[model samples]
Target: GSRQGKDERTTSPSSNFLLSHLQSIIGSPSFPYSSNSPNSLSPLLFLLHSFLRICSIPTGRPIRMGNACGRGKRPAASRDTSARDNEPRVAVNENESDRERDEKPAVTPSPKASMKRSSTPPTGAMVTSRTRASTARRPSTNRSPNASRARDREKEREREKAKEREREKEEEEDDPIQKFITYALNKGVSGLRAEFEELRLKTIPTKEQCSVFHMVANAQKNRYKDVPCSDDSRVILKELSMGTDYIHGNFCGTPKNPKRFICTQGPLPTTIVDFWSMVWQEGSEFIVMLCNFNEMGKVKCAQYFPPTQKETFVAGNAVITCESVAKQKWPGEVTIRRFTLDRIDVNQKRTITHLHWESWPDRGVPPIDATIQKLLQMVCRSSKPAVVHCSAGIGRTGTTVSIQIVTELMDSGKSMETGLGPFLIKMRKQRAGSVQNDQQYVFIHRLLLERYMSEEEKENAKFVKFAKDYDSFMV
Candidate 1:
C-alpha cells in the first residue's frame, strides 16, 4: 500500500506540471503554437492522459508522438475558425501503431503544415501574421510564358505601324507634283494612230558636246553583267576636276541644247558616291529615275537618295539633303522628290529635282505615252544635262532619249522618215547598246509615224475649212 501511494504521488505531480506548461503556452500573446482555441482542449487533455498511461506501462516499446485528430480529420488551418466540436474521435495510439518512427511513410503535407515547416516567424510577428504576409508576397500564378511573348509581339507590330505612318505622312506633306500628276492621270491611252500622233513626246535632246576632253571611262561601274558604255559620249569627270573621273554615260542631243544629259546606270551601293560626284560635276538640276528601287525580289537600284525629308546624308565630298518630297495626285504612278546638294569641298549648294516614274514598267515600255510625255515636259526645261537612269542604263534610257530626240527634230521641221535611223545610229555609236531590241526600235517608228499622220490631218482640216468659207461666200 505504501509503494502504490508513492507511485500515485509521483504521477500526479508530473500531470500537474504538464497541464501548467500547456496553459502558459496558450496564454502567451507573442507565439501562437496551435491553430485550435482554448475551448478545444479536450483533445490535448486526452493526449496527455494517453502519454501518462503509456509512461506507466512497463512494455519495452518506444514512445512516439501521434496526431490527436487522427488520419482523415480536418487539417488545422490558421484562417479556419469553424473546426467542429463534435468530430468523430479516434484513439491517437491507433495512428502511431500503423507506422514505426524508423519506417515512417511519406506524406504530402497540407499548405498550413508546409508553411509551418518551412518558415521561422519574423520578429514581432506570430505564426499567423507571418503566414498571411507570406501569402501576400507571392506573385500572381496565372501568367504564362506564351502569353508574355504574344504581348511583346503585339507591341512590336504597333511600333512598326507607327513608323510606317510617320513615313507616309512625310511623303504627303512634301509632295509638290499635284499639277503634273492631275494631267497625267486624266490622260488615257488612245488606239487611233492618227489621234495619238497629236500626243507628241515632250523632251528635247540635250545640247551637243563641243570638245571630247573628258577623262578615261570604263565598264567597271556598269550593273548589267554583259553590257558596256561607248567612250565617245560617255560622261567623264573632267580630269581630276572633282572625283570619279569616269562614269558610264554620254553627252546626247544636238548643238542647240548642249549639256542636256548625263545618262548613266541606276546607282549601285558601291557607286553612289561616284554618282553624286558626276551630278555635282555636271551641275545637273534634274534626276529622272525610270525604275523602282527594287523589282521582283531583285534590288534594281540602291536607295542612294535620302529616305526621309530634311534628312542629310554624305556621299563622298557631297552632303545631300532630301529637302522635300512630293506625291503626285496619282501618288502610285509618280513621285517628285526635291534634294539640296551641297558640295562640301567647294562650299556650293544646289537644289536638285528627282522625277520618279513609279509606274514605269521595269525592263518594259509604259502602256501609254501620255504619262511619259507629261513627266518629260516638267524635267526637260532644265538647262543642265538631266541625269537619267534605269536598272542597266541602256534599255529604258535608250528608249527615253530616242523619243526626246525625235520630238526635237520634228519641232525643227525635220522629217521623221529620214532622221530616225541616223539619230539611232549616232546614239548607238555614243552608247554601244542604245536600242536594246527590235521592239524598242519599232516603238520609236510607230510614235513618229503616228505624229506624221496627225500633222497631215491638221493640214487637211485647215484646207477644208478654207474651201467651205470660199463656197459659202460664192453662194
Candidate 2:
C-alpha cells in the first residue's frame, strides 16, 4: 500500500538520525551521563522513542511533514506496541539501568499505560508489612537496663508523693480544729491582733438606738443608760399584770446553741425582783457574776443575793436564800456560792450555782489565769442555761461567753476561720453592745491563743516574750 511505503520512508530517516544524535551526546565526557549520578538523559531518550513509534504508524493518509509529536493520533496497531515499548530500545548495562530507575525523575505515562496501571492490584500492603518488621528489629533508646529501672522508680516516687499530698489536704479539710489551729499559728500573735482589729472595725456594727428599748415603759428597766436590750430575744415575764415584763437581758450563744446563756446586766436595787424573776422563768441553774457590788467607791452592782449564809431575801413571788459560800485564791480570785430558789406562788424549789469572779474590773478583761477556765468548766458542768453578767453586761460578760463559744466550736470540729467574727456580730445583734471595746476584742484572741499553746510552750521563755509583746500592743 502507498501509505505503508510512505510510513517506512518517514520513520527510517528521522528515527535513525535522532538515535545516532542521542548516542553521540551520551558518549561525550562533558555530558555527565553516569550510571550512579542523579542527573541523566532518560527522559529525552523516551521522547525520541515515542516520536519514532508515531512515525512508524501506517495510516492511510500521506505522512504529514508537520510536527510528529503534536496533536497527531497513533493508529490502533501502533498504540499497543508503543505502550509496551514506552522505554528506549537502546541497550544499557543492567546495573546502570537500576541506578537510572532509582535516581531519574518519573516520566509522564501515556494514556494506555495509565489504564494498565489502574487495573493492576496495588503493592502498598507488602511495603507496610516490611516497614513493621524493620521497626520491630530496632533497639530501644535507653542507655542501659539499670538506667531504665531508675527512671521508672523515680516516676513511681513522684506519683506516691502526689497521692500523699492529696491525702493530707483531705485530712485538713475534714478536721476543722486542726485547720483552725494551723490558721492561727500561721498568723502569729501580732498578725492575729491586727486581724481582730480589722474584723471588729470593718464587719461589726456600731451600737445604735433600738426602738423597743427606747420605749418609755422599758427605758427605766435598763441598768446602764447606754446599753440597749434587744426586744426579739428579751425574756418576757409571765406575771405581766404586776407591772412591765421588761428585763435588760438577751438570749445569747453560738449558732449551734442560741440559748446557752442569758446575758444580762448587774442587778440594780430596783430590778432585783425582775432579775430573780428572769432566773426562775429561764430555768437557769448557774449565774456568772464578773463584777463586784462596789468598785473604786462606785456602785457597780446591787446586793441582789443574800450576803451571808442562811440569809434570805424575798423579791416578788420568789425567795432566794444563800445556802453556803466558798472562796478560792489559788488559780485565781473567785467566790462560789450556792443558793436555794423557791417560787412561792408555784410551790416549787431549785438550787442555783453562783460563780462570782470579783477580781475582774468593770469594762475590763480579767487576768489570763485558770480562774476563768475553772469558771467556764463550772458553767459547762451545769446542765441548764447559765446567766452571765457584768456591770453593763457587754464587756467581761461578752468576753466570757465568746470564749466558751469559740472553744466549743474548736472542740466540736466546726468551721472557725470567719466564724468568730460572724458569731460576735450575731451576739451583738441580740444584745446591743455585747463586746464593749477593742481591748476586750483583742483579749478574746489572746485567750484563744493561750489555749492553743501547750503547757510546755507556756513555761518557755518564748511565751514570756509573746506575753510582753501582746501587752504592749494592747496598750
> Model 1, 328-369: lDDT tens per residue?
743236778889999888888999998887676665555534
Tell me the spans in candidate 2 whose CA falls farther than 4 Å from its real position.
Answer: 1-175, 178-209, 455-466
User: Mind giving the per-residue lDDT tens digits that candidate 2 earns over 1-475?
Assistant: 2222112122455555665576556545666853223665555555765566566533322222211322223222322233423333322222343446446444444444543454432443233454556556666667678889999999999999999999999977877665555555555566766765766565443334366567778766777776778767777777562377777888886645668888899988778888998888888999999998889999889988987899998988889899999997737878888999999999999999888878877766777766777788878776567999999888889888888887887777787765366667766777767778766776776677677777775676645666777688665
What lDDT is reached at residue 391 by model 2?
91
Candidate 1 versus the native: TM-score?
A: 0.48
Instruction: Spell out the clash pairs found in candidate 2.
Output: none
Over 4 Å off in model 1, which ranges?
A: 1-219, 239-244, 329-332, 448-475
Model 2 scores worst on lDDT over the 10 consecutive residues at 1-10
Alpha-carbon TM-score of each model against the true structure: 0.48, 0.60
Number of clashing residue pairs in every model? 12, 0
lDDT agreement with native, every candidate: 0.59, 0.70
Q: How does residue 473 of candidate 1 score in lDDT?
A: 28
